[model samples]
Target chain A: MPGPTALNFSEATSHDMFAQRLPQSKDDSLPQVLAAAVTHLHALIRELRPTQADWRKVIEFLTDVGHASDERRQEWVLLSDLLGASALVEEINSRRPKTATPNTVRGPFFRADVPQLPLGGNISLDGIGETLDVFGRVQDLDGDPIANAEIITWQANAQGFYENQQPDLQPEFNLRGCFRTDTDGRFHYRTIKPCGYGVPDDGPVGKLLRQAGYPLCRPAHLHFMIKAPEFETVTTHIYDGSDPHLAEDAIFAVKPELVRTFEQQGKGWLLKLTFIMVRARRGAGT
Target chain B: MPGPTALNFSEATSHDMFAQRLPQSKDDSLPQVLAAAVTHLHALIRELRPTQADWRKVIEFLTDVGHASDERRQEWVLLSDLLGASALVEEINSRRPKTATPNTVRGPFFRADVPQLPLGGNISLDGIGETLDVFGRVQDLDGDPIANAEIITWQANAQGFYENQQPDLQPEFNLRGCFRTDTDGRFHYRTIKPCGYGVPDDGPVGKLLRQAGYPLCRPAHLHFMIKAPEFETVTTHIYDGSDPHLAEDAIFAVKPELVRTFEQQGKGWLLKLTFIMVRARRGAGT
Candidate 1:
């Protein structure tokens, strides 16, 4: 059992002045997570010893982050990405086995309505970057083929802008598509190689990146959401290993296992990879 | 010299995958506080092990707080107050001599443009509640009177709303005024006895309070910002000792020294308080 604990600040009688506001009934439904958040916040305040002005600066920064977010742009996601919170959350939840494919942030740009295409179909409607063929296979952890797996993919254009970001300039669903694995569990797509680009830098998250001495660049990568009949859906990214920004992705979404090399195939690039899926628990449907 | 510290998580290679994203420039302006915040956040994530859905909930709640704020209301401040961050900040900055008045949150409702009134002026322009006379004296730590001191005050009307919150119903500047201390450091004013009232309960903060099983009521109190020549300016609040909410002020602004009793006088209540000031540092200005 946990030891007895004080309800407020550990030191100074007047400090935990807010302790009186704790719920009068022990049956209050305040989740343990919220209580933990409060405890962490108190510990932060105690450790940092912030003055009034400093506290106000933080409050204002958060408010600005909120005001900066909208349907098209998620400044909160950018803020979480910049602070490494998003990465940490992914790390905590995605503890995968060595044989299974790792999970990455789904990111804010994902859409559920990507168009379905045939095998080896081209997803780059705008055709702005060097043409490349991405061929990959889907299999279970034991190497059994997971045929008919649904594979959804999206990536930023060569210039690093998602199709939605420049709707007026790019074609609808410019670099987004969904494909099904063949009988042999193989799937392929044609698209321009994604390039490193900065996150939206016109808002408060950008201000924070500048203050933290971090550039806004996220390394080039392809986002994927894969699902099979008996496996859980997985959201992930495969990064270009050669990209310099791989070591300094603005969102910290790069994992070594997710970094793949694009082979030089004449004037274009070619990527061949495999994805391993984990079986879902009984009653869990993909 | 300090010992070496690992750049990321200690247990797994994948978890610290983002370690490479740490700033490459040694001279980066990442404040120590910001670094600490990131560390604490990582610790929280590790402890809670929240899933993607759980993380998204937090992001959505904060966004709502931002969307709720405007020129008249500050939801971020309300969040901080509810979480006790505001009280903690005030406590960290308000260490004072035993005889001096303790400090409290300025609260979001204070307006600097309050009407300046002569001694014994009536500040209750709405004339809606039981009339009361408030008398106060400003004195230094040595118990000597500080004449010509300025007292800026504001409070919720009897209906539990600030004039700015209900501009359409309450008279302009219904319960706000500024007064100058007399030769003996005394000041007096007439106003309706303030009542305990709930905080703005229609925003995300209210949602949080309800979730946490807390009522939104703050104890009855008068806000004060006192300034005297060559003395530190103190922002504080004095609570009515008889208020039932005094023991559970939502914002925790009630310091023992700031609680005063109201004496029955004729058909109204009379409150007497002593405002104590500390000598400002030689170069400090209010």
Candidate 2:
């Protein structure tokens, strides 16, 4: 609420006070901070020498990024990430052990209220694709079992389309569901193999990457957002090693450790991996 | 420019066809790059799992950044830096030089077509503000005088307002001018001392910095974009010490080495510094 108040108020008044004039008293923190930006900005403008047309092109591109979003897609997150701002902020804010699983961009496909299901529950809708059984144990930073941990997953179908993408083709919640770990911190799920897919590039991310000669494919993987009380939620992806583009996914996400190799046995491959979560440091008054 | 046509048209279509669709045989390099971006994008979306509102926020922020730009400002560049995309891309593209000056965001306050004044030109307008003599030598990587180099300089008045900021109080280009190096690659200018100033806090960088608890003030500095016929143009700032808020300038631009201590004499102070520029490798095109 106070955001709009401060932002909108400054424009109307103090036309020359900011960027040129200093605050009178000891409380000139905001003005001082802004001066550096403006000064640097002034120099940058000289070097860049962008014309009005160049400015409009960027504006139109940004507007198109907005117009490209829909109920099933999010172009903004992709743009933030390709631009490197999202990943940089994440690195600045979320510093954890490199040995511990690294966190990348949290994409725009998760639902807030995924229906909670019991441990050992099968989340696959009608279990149609490859019959793979997945099991994992959850632990805290100190390798302690984090009982009652919640594991949520959502992925595209065999053709790499989510249920939201094709309501008529896929069942509601197909390859999407939530499961809480048991007392031993172990959980299991039965689902089909997820195929790798590409982002919605009919928009700005596509435009930029296309110009810069970047690829637009992600290897097959299952999405996971694991959470428990007092611990940091690890939103991650487990990529299948066999996917064609596992190494060169455009987002630069393919941690050698995150890619798990699957062994095909009888009818399907058995997927088993242990998950380790870290306890979050509480801020002041948290 | 081939900028717009560089983005492929065919792959910039629907989601199902766009994902994982790398250009293989006939799609040309553009399609290959665009398809790659979409592929990773598809995964990024699955991973970040952003809501529609979250997606809209990013688009709106970028739009506002572009919309905030004017002749005197370019918020889009600042936005790119704030997002960490620029630095990352630069790091990826440019070779890291430990001794060489680091490249940073070229802010948006520089004006084009600064008059080419001769060596030892006095750029101070009407003897306004505090009197100071600024001198500098431009040298090659091996300490050779970069003769005939062009050095453009500008700064705010004692009140911290540039000539452009206040047309009434200051003359046109009051504190801004350009000077060329002598055959020995040296130049000098007489100007008034500029105090620290704030950027327009009403802009996007200001709003975001305040929200992030970043102080908005910057130390005083002169703008410099040095260029020689055969050398890579270097756009940088020469910082002034003895200014308040030097340590916590919100833009992260306080380089201790770049600061020149002013020596007080009878009436004015003299600040001397040297610009060590790396020469462009022979035949290296800009």
Using lDDT, give the best candidate's number. Answer: 1
Question: In model 1, which runs have C-alpha deviations exceeding 4 angstroms?
Answer: A1-29, A113-121, A167-169, A182-184, A283-286, B1-30, B143-148, B182-184, B282-286
lDDT of 1 at B172: 86
Q: How much is B252 displaced in model 1, in angstroms?
A: 2.0
Give a tens-digit lDDT track for model 2, residues A214-254.
56677888888888888777877788878877655555445
lDDT of 2 at B95: 44
Error of 1 at A105 (Å): 1.7
Q: Least accurate stretch of 10 residues (summed lDDT) in model 2 chain A?
A: A1-10
**DockQ for all models:** 0.42, 0.03
How many residue pairs clash per model? Answer: 0, 45
- The CAPRI quality class of candidate 2 comes to incorrect
- Expressed between 0 and 1, the share of native interface contacts present in candidate 2 is 0.02
True interface contacts reproduced by each model, as a fraction?
Answer: 0.50, 0.02
